[model samples]
Target: MNTSKQRPVRVAIIGLGWWGQKMVSILKSCGTELEIVCAVEPNPAAGDFCANNGLTLAASYDAALARADVDAVILATPHSLHPEQIDRGAAARKHIFCEKPLALTKADAERAVRLCREAGLVLGMGHERRFEPPIVDILQKASGGHLGRILQIEANFSHDKFMTLNKSNWRLDPQEAPVAGMTATGIHLTDLSVKLLGAAYDVRVSCETLASDFRQGDTFSAHVRFKGGGTAYVSATLVTPFVSRFAVFGTKGWIDVRDKAHVEAPAGWIITRASVGSLIEISEVGPAEPVRENLVAFARAVRDGRPYEISGEDLVNNIALLEAIIRSAASGEVVAVG
Candidate 1:
């Protein structure tokens, strides 16, 4: 087992929307050490979620941040709103675990990381794919020289429908959705791509405007070139029926995760690796509770004061790469991503 043992983290979730509510549900089951102390949400669904779970619901993040009871804050608000919330949480001396992209722009993402650093707080971005037990096991196999020399990976995440019109939230807006479904979700693929493939160098992307109702970019695809002569050509389509999932390919084998559909569409996962004698296929079904692993990882990171499997720098760089994809899609050119 890992040597890090942290006391249960005192957690608060801001913007308890669809995903945010799930975060709370998973954290709730995380034993007595972990706790959901407060919630900051404008929507009634969030309030209901907290009430049903017996969690304290705060009317605003400002109030939640001021409270001494909250030890950490999870920013599940919106893409454009992430940076400021993280900044506020850091200033309030709370550890932060944000959903994705970090922010709508690279500068904003950079500032979020910088602010978190200044506060000496552990900043975790929710790229929960890294926590998938099978995925973790696969990465270990590769590092153990079972894959010989790694080559390429293809990761994809798609979404077509959203249950947002009822809520009157920012996600339905183009500014919040940003570069379509990719920024909202596919950054997981890019972040995973970086971990498996090495530093992504140049990104060439293409996005189609599939939704007439949506104001900004809707459907997006990108090809990221990794420095080690590997590639992660990732895509996110809002027109598709599936939700979040990931796939990785190495020289000796390939692994695919089919996230069980939950409106979130995680389904299950399948792993295939090549051995000296034959091919091996291994699969693991997801939990009735999916977000528990993510919260536990964060709580452990906070308690241990060590590096997590995921980080803010990775989120910023992934957002930077996503931003490059948007630029490339707009300009029809290859964008160099640092």
Candidate 2:
């Protein structure tokens, strides 16, 4: 509603890891509305990246927060530090856009969301899969009754990139990435499922590590029972070949979506009706710059008072289900979401 298209949003990128660099590239290459004014990274190696991109390398997060030019902060830091970083960013009256999981625990996520709301700041989570064309169609049809009553959903996001990660990598640490692949890839499915079928009330998980060299577990599968009477399954693996698939099953028909492990390539989807024929296929070949769209959305919220799509309650509920999955895997029992 704030038609001020000329307004610029100054943003700071935290963390200088591979994923952080990816965000930087998207913002620079896609010509989005966001401007990367500064970056908070402790690694001296990232100084050149900052210098080349015209971003000031802040000595610390506090230093970045103190800057007047920064209107929002995109946090790509470790999961352990998300809650504290979000709290600090909100306290500084800056909009916060954090990568998925928000926080590892429900308590931390609730605190982060609460502080952001209390400070009247936008809290955006980086679950960009919702922006995918196929995913958009699924959500649209499901809401429009084309999919009838949704009964089940299945999603699996797996890649072999983790196989090369070293022990020092935080993702290889259990404390940082729990329930095997849940934190890395499966969380997207959980977020998407929650979007389709309210919050999950319980979770049953079976995860294990078959690779002896892998620091963290390599395989994970979780079954979620939603409060809205829908069931979902999410699976992820580190040793398998790259594959990404999502499907929604309904009483009348089903929609299946598949994509490459990388985002640069196009994705395809299929809609099936028992009486209509075999299947209808749709291929999306254009660039799917979800990260850019996500950043632009955040900027719109900051500049024009437009609400960020991900709400505080949704953020808290996402982490709640994640915690339940982790717990279920550990105890080998179905855990009730808190």
Candidate 3:
């Protein structure tokens, strides 16, 4: 979508962890729209990753910001650091593409978004599920009135990475990942629900530790009431095997997109119509590469001055929903989303 004839964007990648490295690898084959020219990582092991990948290792984010060639920054750092990193990147007048949740709190998210708006810089978040093909298909049908008055939606995304961890990590901290699985998995479905069902006004949640060696819990679920009269239920567990599922029920029909637990597996879907006799099978190979597509979308937005799909209000609303979910879980009462 970045139809500009300008040269490719030279980006500085901060954080060289697993997700950060994944982004670097994707950018290698991510075409001519963007390029990773430098990286910042304090870990000595990341030095070899940078060297092997022909990237300059900067001592700190300030060093990366000082480079004139570095047109933007891709933040793959922890969730808590996003607000400050985005603030610094925006201050430097560099386009920013930060990984999701944006910020754990509504105020932080709003401030980060406001800073980018005032700086006239493109701000993109890593809600990559927006680029998934099955999601696109469902959205198209809903928009076309084919789904016919979407009544309710349900989704569940879970994985066992928390149970698999033996050593202490940031994810185990309540400050970093409060609400446990909600921050890790439920947030993705929450973003999707926000995009599809509009802003949620009331939230009721149940979060408990079923099995975990860490201080945080392993299971979480939330029921949300949208301002538009739609309802949604989302659940996740940190001790379960990998699984991702999304379903929507409407007056005319219903659709279920079941994604394989493994990241490498292609997602499939099934749709059932009230008038039809049997469930319709929709099989498709080549699930949309969400991470790659999200990067490209950000590149296009930066290069062409195009608007990113998720609006500023959506960012704030999503965080409000997250905060409300946590509050409800703690209070055992339905919390009103601001």
Q: Which parts of model 1 have CA positions greater than 4 angstroms off?
A: 1-7, 44-49, 163-169, 243-245, 260-267, 275-277, 280-290
Model 1 TM-score, 2 decimals: 0.87
Q: What C-alpha root-mean-square deviation, in Å, does candidate 1 show against the real structure?
A: 3.5
Candidate 2, residues 246-278, lDDT tens digits: the string is 899887678777775465333444333331244
List, in order, the clash count of every candidate structure: 11, 0, 0
Across 100-150, the per-residue lDDT of candidate 3 in tens digits comes to 778888999899889988888888888877777778778888889887888
Cα lDDT tens digits, model 1, 1-338, are: 12224456787888777788777766767995478888888866666666788988887889988887678888888887787788778878888888877776778888888887787777877777777666677678777877666677766677666533533557657666756677667777787877666666898877777654555566777888866787777877766676555666666666666665632434556454455556666656655333567767777778776567765566667777777776787787888975
- lDDT against the true structure, per candidate, is 0.72, 0.82, 0.82
Candidates, ranked, TM-score: 2, 3, 1
Q: What ranges in model 2 sit over 4 Å off?
A: 1-5, 30-32, 264-285
List candidate 3 stretches off by more than 4 Å: 1-4, 264-279
Error of 3 at 109 (Å): 1.5
